[model samples]
Target: MTAIEIRNLSKSFGAVRAVDDVSFTVEAGTVTGYLGPNGAGKTTTLRSLLGLVTPDSGEALVNGRRYASLDHPLNEVGAVLEATSFHPGRTARDHLRIMTTAAGLPASRPDEALDQVGLADAARKRVGGFSLGMRQRLALAGALLGQPKIFILDEPANGLDPAGIQWLRGFLRHLAHDTGAAVLVSSHVLAEVEQTVDNVVIIAKGRLVRQGTLAELTGNGGGAVRVKTKDDFAPALRAAGAEVEEVEPGLLRVKGLDAEEIGRLALDQRVLLTEVTHERSDLQSVFLELTAEGERA
Candidate 1:
């Protein structure tokens, strides 16, 4: 099930094109990581989807309808954008209580959400005294007040400690894999994302650069072989119909052939390889490769 869809979405602020013809979908029962560098139109695309910003062209749909057109928006989508703020004097429970009341949700929802986000112990603490990580959890608790099926979170892991981050990883996965919700998390933390996300939507310079499952983006299902050789094996590898890239002066990233095959071919061609290792591309490497300025479309 497609929970969120952005079709040909483009938005401009004066002369700056914040988003340009970017499109992607988030499926139900999966966590999609929306990743990009600073000022890469990630937030703009998300804002457009939440109806916080109107697009110049294209569509941002929630369950096949515009967000504003939904009869009960809060019951369908829960968003925790970067600019989330709370009254300094309000207790965590109070803040959530206010939200539940405003959204016509049950009063018990505040406590339930606080417990869900692990903020039950601090429910009575004023927002001003909470640490950044605690505040982040509080904000998340507010978003959970409606118990919506779709979550749109921006930089959700910011300010979290190592343990908190680890907990968040499991929390998100449980939400999607266990309960069958759809989650879209936008963040620049690549390592954490590599572990937490099922799918990835990457953008660069206001353009959709890549979108696929974690395995597809990372090339983990059938990884390439990285060969370091003093002699030239590029010609032989190419001749054998292998896609070879000289990633460095003497280092080659060879696809379409396994390490054993490459080693045999290298020996037959009299190429002395110093290294022949299968390389599983990580999210950070692939992200940098796709979003690098020189490689942009």
Candidate 2:
């Protein structure tokens, strides 16, 4: 079953429509990337889902009910929208202890959550002494305190170094794979999301422009066959109904045909081929093209 659902959701701030008829679903046991340019209404949509902002039309549902209708909402959904606030003088353990107590969870949960995020060793250190990466981890630890079934994180990798980002990628995958959690992560880091998420939901001007698995979205754009031959085969390949572009000396990028087809055409044209391979379009380029098109429209 779908863990999170937004149906025809629209929100406005005076004369500005932040989100307009946006709709999407996040399923269990998978990570879905929520992506959009600045001012595209991603934050507004998430805030509406968490009941921090009410939508003007439609609804945001968590497990078939509105977030406000849920019993023990914290235990059902965990969110890390921004760097969590904490008393600078308080130790990490103390901060978590307060949250654990408020959530009515066992005292041991704080320690477990800390260890899960690799912050166990810093439990006794004051929050003021921590770096940005450490604070990001602490916020994530707090989100996991309830062992919630769904995780909604906005820019969770903010302030994380390369190593920290890598760790988060694996941790998020583990949560969805082993624990059957539904994760919706919003970020402007397209490359990281391209590698980490199973599916993607892209928005522009507060409307959903695309939503599908990585393969579905990327693969549909078609692939190009790169070939290197001793002799130029661009003319022959073009005559065979393939779009050919000379990438560099002795190299050609062929579209509307696969590597095998390219090879067969080269052989028929008596071209001595040295290399042939297929390359898929990168997600970053695709994302830019999509958003740019939306802007023009």
Candidate 3:
């Protein structure tokens, strides 16, 4: 079942349209990246889903129902939209305990949530003394207090160091893979999101520009073949209906064919190839291209 759905959702701020006819879905047991350039209406869309902002038209649904209409909202959806707002003097454990109680979860939930986010060791530390990464973990712990089936996070890796980011990636993957949870994470870090999410929804000017699995989105233009030949083979490669460009001396980037085809063509032409590697478009390049196109439109 789809965990999150947005259909023709739009929101306007006076004369400006922050989001326009955005539509997408995030399925269960998957981690979907929600991405866009600044002012692309990503946060506004998320707010609409959470009932923090009312959409001017259309609807945003969670598990087929409006977020505010859910019987047990916290138990059904866990969200960390921004940094955790904690009392400076409050201990991490106390902060989580308060949320656990408010959410109607058991007292033991605070510790479990802390352990889930690897913040157990800092349970007694005052939040004011905690690092930015630790505070992020605390916010995540609060979200997990009810063990929600769906998670919505915005810029989750903002304050995380390299190690924390890696840990978060693994934790999010485990949530979707092992626990059958649905995760929608929004971030500007396309490279990290590419590595972490199963699928992506990219927006620009508040409208969806692309939505698909990583492979489906980046699989266009077939694949590029990087060939290292003993001699210049650009002319021969171009003759074989491939677009060839010399990346470096003796290294040619060939498009419009697979590596095997490139190898066969080179062999047939008596060009000895030292290396032939297939290359796929990374998320960063694809994202930049889509957003840039949207701006030009």
Which candidate gets the maximum TM-score versus the true structure? 2
The order by descending TM-score is 2, 3, 1
Q: After superposition, how far is residue 247 of candidate 2 from its true place, in Å?
A: 2.3
**lDDT tens string, model 2, 1-297?**
679999999999999989999999999999999987878888899988998898999999989889888767778898887775778899999998998888788889889999999999999999999998999899899889999999999888889999999999999999898999999999876976778899989888888888899877786555888888869688888888999889899988889889888877877888899989777677777677777766666
Better model by TM-score, 2 or 3?
Answer: 2
TM-score, structure 2 vs. true: 0.89
lDDT measured at residue 67 in model 3 versus the true structure, 0 to 100 = 96
The alpha-carbon deviation from the true structure for residue 46 of candidate 3, after best TM-score superposition, in angstroms, is 1.3
Which TM-score value belongs to model 1? 0.85
Runs off by more than 4 Å, candidate 3 = 221-223, 228-233, 248-250, 256-277
What's the best-to-worst order under lDDT?
3, 1, 2
lDDT value for model 3? 0.88
Model 2 RMSD in angstroms: 2.5
RMSD of each: 4.2, 2.5, 2.6
| Model 1 ranges off by over 4 Å | 220-277, 293-296
Could you give candidate 1's per-residue lDDT for residues 147-172 as a string of tens digits? 88999888888988999989889988
